[model samples]
Target: MSKRKKAPSGNPANRGLSFVDRRIARDFERWLAASDTPLSDPHNAAGAVGHLFDITKRSGLDILEPSDTADIADMLLDIGPNATGMVDLFHDYVHFRLETSRDPRWHQAHDELEDVLDDDTGISAMLEAIITDAETRDPAVIADALAHTKVIDGVTKLLDWISTSRPITDTGALRLSDIEPAAAALGLRAAGARTLPATGDLHGQTAIADGITYVQSMWHLEPLAAWWRALLDTDVLELTASRVRPGRASQRWRTEPTPPLDVASEVVALVVSDTVLGDLPRPLRLGCFTLPGARHTCARGPHPRRRRQARTPHRDRRTIRPPCRTRLADARRSRPGRTDPQPPRHPIRRSRGLARRLCYRPARGPR
Candidate 1:
């Protein structure tokens, strides 16, 4: 008996393609055939989908087949969503898998879809939303979301590391040495620390290179930007920048001597009352009053929001503190029974007495 020829899965030979799908498939096949396709181009999900749609139309290939689509997704994942020419393509392909594939592997694609959709909105806001969602999402759902969005782990982890530090203080002197280990542990791709040319009035400060993944890692962008902004806002950093010549070849970080206790105390008081201080993240604001080993105590005390215990308004010339006991004791010893201290007496000026005598002396003619 002759053996029967086995049919190809999904009946690929019989699959029909639409005009647009065919066009997209033709372009994709052409792109795949090319030896050099720059991968750095930025495109959104819809654009990526449009490309894929054209590919399907041109090739008459059922690219949406679950197994084949899964393989496609894997290839895109390895290339990364930020790869030139790949971001939108990956996004579009994943969306297709989510909509058509029955494979459980693609179910979490919606989470990634949400993120890809959010890419155009701005990385800072996008990352903040993701972090907020992470706080509320089920552990399994978040894990799946993390798995689906390849860069989410690195992005969120970097944000986590940044958020954990006191923003302004820690960021003021941020170095690669401080961030590298954590970045490595979290799988973040941190660039080498370098000195940059002065930006405007600001001097060349310690700076971290923004790798290609910087944009792809949306959640980290805001915190990183905020950190740099905070560092720039530092008075000491600015002072150091003012002192250094921008074109210097030697890479040296300029540091200001720690403020003396009185200066630091005054600064703490000034910071606590400033409207801008209220706007800073609590962690950053909290560290502004740091001293060697002890935190500077604000005379006004903690949070500005809480109603300060209703202090009696001081009347002009009114005494707030009682008279010193030493003065009272001396006054008592002088007077023998006085409870209140008498005002100290002032000796009459000898110059004034001499002038009075000269004015009052009757015609003492011949002396």
Candidate 2:
């Protein structure tokens, strides 16, 4: 096959075109100027708002940020309110504008207000129209839309105001009434306020205590242990508890590697014996109790006594016999050294004997 050729890499003949077609850019600049005037006109405000909304949406730029808001506001000013019909359109636009200002970014709000107020008509009429519209629109839809339009400047100003009051412990405690005007000025709705705790009320304390008790309950223990086991087995968590800090309790615990097989087996046995068996009533305990078997003659399909007999291990054991006479032979040979080489010792037998003697094993020699 023929080799493919690489394209030229240096600046091309169309470099300027690549940078944003100067003519189209200028056209957009002019349109922006024209939009300000049209936006002020009641008849033209909707279309301008729609266009600005679309532009900002498509740009993926946050219009709430100071830099973006300032840039957009400057562009709007350049377009000038005179170009659009009715100076009132500008007022409407300003009144419906959402607060996009964030903390410490007063520049955008200052610049935008300055630019708009500089116009002879001012923005009050637009505000009145917006307030009227808000009264008529669905509150839920308005709330959602207002949430999206939050201006950083409005939030910052409200926070600052709340800070001065000392009545609110935190900005989070401020009510809608406290910030509604700021929100309105930014063309947004104020959300409802939350109630504060009354003095001497211990609701938060009670909740914490209840949560701790719920966490400590035995029913939650196994699940919690399993969760911790899974975490450790996955190698994301270390077994050492020292790594955790008091204030960082909210941090997720990491997973560790799977535990040794013997440990897992022991855990399973403990869960079955200590947890399950210990939970049963004494008379119904496994291996110690006999349960009934099915009795076809009974209306309930089984007599309790028969069912108990079926479950009883002693009854089952009576029906089975040892595989060979090895045990008898071992018993005979075990009596005083008959010395016909004793039948090979079973590993299980050796294990049982070793286990019985384990308590007597000597301590290891000093290292």
TM-score of 1: 0.18
Candidate 2 lDDT by residue in tens digits, 285-359: 112110010000111221121112212233221112121222244443432212253222111101111111111
* Model 1 local distance difference test score: 0.32
Model 1 CA deviation exceeding 4 Å by range: 1-84, 116-367
Candidate lDDT (C-alpha), each: 0.32, 0.29
TM of each candidate vs. truth: 0.18, 0.16
Q: In every candidate, how many clashes are there? A: 13, 37
